[model samples]
Target chain A: AQRVTQPEKLLSVFKGAPVELKCNYSYSGSPELFWYVQYSRQRLQLLLRHISRESIKGFTADLNKGETSFHLKKPFAQEEDSAMYYCALKKAGSARQLTFGSGTQLTVLP
Target chain B: NAGVTQTPKFRVLKTGQSMTLLCAQDMNHEYMYWYRQDPGMGLRLIHYSVGEGTTAKGEVPDGYNVSRLKKQNFLLGLESAAPSQTSVYFCASSLRGTSGVAGELFFGEGSRLTVL
Candidate 1:
């Protein structure tokens, strides 16, 4: 069994401040991690995957094997960045199945 | 392109009533999934299909059933509605599953179901 945990239920930050959404995972085998976002009145979309090692909308996440963590970070928060974010994990050889975390609602205030 | 579309955007059902949520994808995906979202639980997979004729149970498949008679369509059925079944259902699809690659999911707008 695999599990993904997003510790924070809600995170609020002032515009231009740095923000981080913490995620942890428990999986026996090597795992694939991803971050997904859902904006108000919009469908959930993929923000980025760990393997991509690329930033999207100024947000980046680094998967740490030793600590079993994948934290999403943004250098400077923007108002438009406010949204619900989910951290998900897929065990190796598990097909396309994904186990999602409870999610964190990020609010960027002006 | 209507990547993934779920029918009956919103529905209300009483106890013992039956309903089926239809999901269709036009992206020619090989994998489709049905998940229910609650206030704090995020998304729990109810059922999934890897291809046209095969369906598999997911984490929360006890109260639901699924069918995948066609490659592009996956249907989720609730034989008897329960209060606990009220939730926002999401349909998603991905091209294919490889060993190390976690295929990104394309999701539908979602279907809100209320059981009274």
Candidate 2:
């Protein structure tokens, strides 16, 4: 079975501090992982995909095959970055269904 | 363009009552999915459709039915509401890819259902 786990339910960090949201997955086939964020009163949207390897809004995530993890990181946190973040994995098949983790609520305190 | 739209953004139903949640996407996506968001449970896939007239159950499908009579629309129906069924439902769509799996999904604002 394929599963995504976000161990932290809530993470708080002060502005300008570094931030890391851990995400781990268990899958038999190659994995395709993504981070999604939802701001207040906003619909959930894609933050970044491991395949892209590109940073979005100063946040980056590298897929670690050895650890089976795709942790999202940011050099400096911002108050605007506070939101609910979810880690999702695309199943390795034609179904293309997304399996999401429980989610992490990040709070950037000033 | 309305990427994805869900009707009845909010609804309340008594237990044992039936209701249907409609999801429509204007992106002409080939795939549509229904998911329910619960506290600390993340989003669980209830059902999905790859194309018109095709439907498949996902991680959680009990007490739910879906239909894709039209390519751009997918409907999720509940035969009888229950307190456990109360949740925020989200509809998402994605374009088909040559790689066999669909791409990034576009989601709607969501529909909050309260079961009494």
Clashes of each: 0, 0
> Using Cα atoms with residue i matched to residue i, what is each candidate's TM-score against the true structure?
0.98, 0.97
iRMS values for every prediction: 0.6, 0.8
Model 2, which residues run further than 4 Å from truth? B98-102
Docking category for candidate 1? high
Per-residue lDDT of candidate 2, residues A1-110 (tens digit): 89999999999999999999999999989878999999999999999888788899999999999999999999999999999999999876556689999999999999
Q: What interface RMSD, in Å and to 1 decimal, does model 2 have?
A: 0.8
DockQ of 2: 0.81
Q: Tens-digit lDDT track for model 2 on B55-78? A: 999999999999999998999999
DockQ per candidate: 0.86, 0.81
User: Which regions of candidate 1 fall more than 4 Å away from where they truly are?
Assistant: B97-102
Q: Which ten residues in a row have the lowest lDDT in candidate 1 chain A?
A: A89-98
Residue-wise C-alpha lDDT for candidate 1, range B7-44, written one tens digit per residue: 99999999999999999999899999999999989999
